[model samples]
Target chain A: MSNGYVFLSIAAMAVTTYLIRMLPMAIFRKKIENRWIKSFLYYVPYVVLSAMTFPAIFTSTGSVLGAASGCAVAIMLAYFDKGLLTVAIGAAAMAFIVQFAGM
Target chain B: MNLKEVKEGIKVGIPIALGYFAVSVAFGVSSVQSGVPFWGATLISLTNLTSAGQKAGVDVMAAGGSIFLIVLTTLIINMRYFLMGVSMSQKVEEKMPMWKRLLIAFGITDEIYAMSMSRSTHLTGSYMAGLIIPPIFGWTGGTLVGSVATGFMPSILAEAMGIALYGMFIAVIVPPSRRNGNVLLGVISAVILSVAFTYAPVLQIFSEWSVIIITVLVSAFMATFFPVKEGADNE
Candidate 1:
């Protein structure tokens, strides 16, 4: 793409991003008093993070074994109360090992 | 908005800025390495204030994804912020003008919102503005400097520093997970769902969007049904 096209693309993306971000607050100014709705919103981040992180663990090489091993490492680390860095590293390490071992 | 509140916002934001400095510098360096123009990456980092989304954007760009795919994927990743902004809107004084609300809302990162909401002090408009100062400067400053100095940092060093972002996430996930059983459930559920989606064959029809949808639905199902009682912050 040309420089102009790239700039336009970025601008378009930026606008979409900004409006998506700002619109909820603009539309829903009232405090969410509904219990179920509030509960749903509270879990939104956890859901978002999970969605983003899940596919990477098992699908790095289009294989299930590697992904499963990687996720097992991550879950173990998380269960043991290892910090984010540890979980990431543990999972990445397991994935790398699985890849190297050709298992 | 009084001068004092701005000052207080700056004071409160300083630590956040310091934290941003290290991580954002890593982000800047990586973006440049991934073939984005330094200015473009710097501007995105300055304006967006979202590290994971930016990283995902860079990865997509590196893989030569189309503009539509890139933006769509990023939008999907960042949808949680909409709810975050809603919660913040509820926290602020009702009559705050739209323009001011828009301006202040730019600073609603995970840390800043938490700190601002947790305070017992009734925040004036200036105080709220002040809260944004350090992080904005810290993030912008880090991106600007790191973009220019990108070539000097070794890749291994940059990779090591990238751990900071993960560390920040750990800090967030751990404390709360320990305090509440529901939070722990949410985290574990996320991990399990993530693994399942990655591995299962018949379910492979799910794209990134499906992963997001399923995770959100599953987590909301868990959290809503098993509601964790949270302590309210008195401001």
Candidate 2:
């Protein structure tokens, strides 16, 4: 909750992010070989987000049931290729309904 | 100065800026709800244009994560940018100076990189500037508005907005899983691992670093088994 800590944390995040972006430009002059490495890097985004979403999402709602209900809706909406806002609002509103219904 | 290219770049950047504007609002609301002060959230948005990384960073902070953990998590989540920067480096005009390369790399992002790569010719510094400037503004502006929005919005809606953060994360990971088996497998594996980490009493202690460790293990595991064919970068 301390502003100072949050600021420092954000600064660290910014520097780390900038370095990740800047390092290849600064040092990597050749095409990366090792298809395994390339493939691993390519899949990083999906895996990281996946791991972050699960378990975390289940606990993020007012109740576990609400989170689960909302999650089902999100899955269906996203499977249908709903936009970000649509999926977000859909899940949140559903969670709200579940919570309001005293589930 | 290639004013025409800059204008065109900005024009092309419009969609990206609008996207950033929308996404950053979610970030702002979440960060503030995560215990970040409004100004602190805005600053985070201003300095770190990373969507996933910034969100993850705030999540770590809200969890009372260590500085080292925050830095490492941010670095790992953002490692994709290294590949992006390398590809962008190859796309810039050959004579573009190293300093300019560094400057332009500051704006390297999924949207900016995509917009730049769509160009038939090499990108220039001015165009890169135009490409990033509005998105940056839109992102920061959205955060500014969102961080302060709790003052006006009802708590019920604010709580709903809280769930919206997870909604965004699901939105990002679920769609791709529908089409790509590798993505699907990676996601499914990570989900099972993460759920185990959360629910299993003995495994719960590893929760702090579980995501990062499992991400590496699952990704490398997928890459080894399901390597993408050469010349097709997911597309």
Please give, for residues B37-148, the per-residue lDDT of candidate 1 as tens digits. 7787777777677766766666666556567766776676566667667777877777878887787777777778778878776555788788887788888788877766
**Location of the lowest summed lDDT over 10 successive residues in candidate 2 chain B:** B154-163
TM-score, structure 2 vs. true: 0.93
Model 2 bad stretches (over 4 Å): A63-66, A96-103
Number of the top-ranking candidate, with DockQ as the measure = 2
Colliding pairs, model 1? A54-B194, A58-A67, A84-B170, B9-B130, B9-B131
**Once model 2 is optimally superposed onto the true structure by TM-score, how far is the C-alpha of residue B19 displaced, in angstroms?**
2.0
Which pairs of residues collide in model 2?
none
TM-score of chain A of each: 0.62, 0.85
**Per-prediction TM-score, please?**
0.73, 0.93
Q: Give the residue spans of candidate 1 off by over 4 A.
A: A1-9, A24-27, A50-103, B64-76, B93-95, B196-211, B227-235
